[model samples]
Target: MDLFDAINQRHSYRGPLLADPVPRTDLRRIIQAGLQAPSGRNAQTTEFIIIDDPVLLAKLQAMHPANQAMQQAPAMIACLIDRQPAAVYEGYNFQIEDCAAAVENMLLAITALGYASVWIDGWLRLEQRADRVAQLLMLPTDKKLQILLPIGRPAEHWPQKERKPFAQRAWFNCYGAEETPCQ
Candidate 1:
């Protein structure tokens, strides 16, 4: 799919995914897209753990009860961030921003490749889930697992949700000055 079409079609797919496995080559391509994302000061604090092992996926599913999508996905990508201070300014860590950019890139790639996925982050922040996931992946103390992307074909199609009108959400020159929508 074209870049603009992929962007327009991409949606959070929380429903079950098809049973077919995602090819390793496609997974690599998706990860490459994420790795190419621009990072703050080129710190590149983001890392990925591509999980396709059935046993491992089952364990992760057990750990995150709310992540039903992960349970059915043929493959998943765990997005990790290095907590070690890198490109820090005024005691602010840019790892979150760096990882977020990477995730967005991967999401776009997933859509372009005719696959479906959802950015799984909120569950990682709840009930010590991140800590448990980190332990399951046996990550080093400095590496933190922050997000997951379950990749596969959607079991059912969902219509794209409507977005706020461009004119209502965007402006030009000054805040709320020009309500003209982008062409």
Candidate 2:
């Protein structure tokens, strides 16, 4: 699919997913897209662990029992982030920004590949779920699980989410300015 189409089609797929496993090749392609994302100061703080094993998937499903998408997804991607990342721009680290960029890229890729996924962050933030996930993955202490994406084919179709009009959400030269700017 075209980039714009993928971007338009990409939604947080919270519905149940099919049981079919996402091929490793497609997973690699998705991750490659994420790797190609521009990191803040090129810190490239994002790392990934693709989970396709049924046992691990089952464990994750149990962890998020209330979420049908999490339970039915045939595969998942865990995005790991560096805690004490070297400040590449100023004195502050941009690990979160880097991870977000990478995730967006991967989401687009997933949509293009005919797969569906949801950016699962808020749920993981509650009750130390992310820490437990990191432990299950045997991730290093320095690497924290910042994001999780459950991926598979959707069992049902969902409508594209409505986007705000450009005039309301964006402007030209100045904040809240008209798109064309002064003549």
Best by TM-score: 2
lDDT tens readout by residue for model 1, 1-183: 899999999999888788999999999999999999998778788999999998988888776556557778889999998767665666677888989999999999999998999998888888888899889889999988989899999888876689998879777866676656444
TM-score (all chains, Cα) for each model: 0.92, 0.96
Which portions of model 1 miss their true places by more than 4 Å? 88-92, 179-183
lDDT of 2: 0.92
Clashes of 2: 0
Candidate 2's displacement at residue 16, Å, is 0.9
Cα-lDDT of candidate 1: 0.87
Best lDDT among the predictions, by candidate number? 2
Query: Whole-model Cα lDDT per candidate?
Result: 0.87, 0.92
- Poorly placed runs, candidate 2 (over 4 Å): 179-183
Please provide the root mean square deviation of candidate 2 (C-alpha atoms, Å).
1.4
